[model samples]
Target: MSVIAVNDGTFVSELEGKGVTLVEFGAVWCPPCKVLLPILETLSEEYAEGLRVLKVDCDESPVTASRYGIMSMPTVIVFKNGEPLEKLVGLRPKSAYTNVLGKINAEAARL
Candidate 1:
């Protein structure tokens, strides 16, 4: 699947279902956020079966950003069943994000 752009109005609904969601809260002005976009796009397609990728521009969606206590751009949050499970602030290696997904996959397997 492709990364979906979300905002304050659509954020809750987009995350309101079963499965895993990775949401990146960022802004077009942030250099690192720009750097991370394609990485997320790649992951979205690779994990298309079970993961959904979303992007929220902080500048355009302050309500969503503030609700999550996002102090910086590129705050990536992993959610399961509409609840936040983990958050990574700033730019991180793709492996760091993959490790998170691996853990989630493990949880699903155990269930």
Candidate 2:
């Protein structure tokens, strides 16, 4: 499935009820953002049942970026229980995301 496109209006509401959400704020022109695409896609597929991955195009939706205070491209925010738990900036290894997911899952299991 394609990454869900989120914007200023829908981002908060959509993520509020969802148990966990991973949001990527990027633009098509950003090289680092492009590089992170595959990683997000792979993780999205692997954690389809538990995690929700969404993308916001900075160029297309500046409001979303501003709302999140995203000053750079490819700002990844991990939200758990309607609040941001972790954030990653720039190009990072897939492990960065997997590790976060693991933490979320582990904590969720204890709940």
Best by TM-score: 1
What digit string (tens of lDDT, one per residue) describes model 1 on residues 1-111?
A: 988999999999999985899999999999999999999999998898799999999999999999999998889999998999999999999999999999988998999
How would you encode candidate 2's per-residue C-alpha lDDT over 76-101 as one tens digit per residue? Answer: 99998778889898889999899988
Backbone clash pairs for candidate 1 read: none
TM-score of each: 0.97, 0.90
Provide the global lDDT of candidate 2 against the true structure.
Answer: 0.87
For model 2, give the RMSD to the true fold. 1.4
Instruction: List where candidate 2 sits over 4 angstroms from the true fold.
Output: none
Compute the lDDT of residue 61 as modeled in candidate 1. 94
What lDDT would each prediction earn against the true structure?
A: 0.94, 0.87
C-alpha lDDT of residue 31 in model 2: 93
Lowest-lDDT window of 10 residues in candidate 2? 1-10
Question: Highest lDDT, which number?
Answer: 1
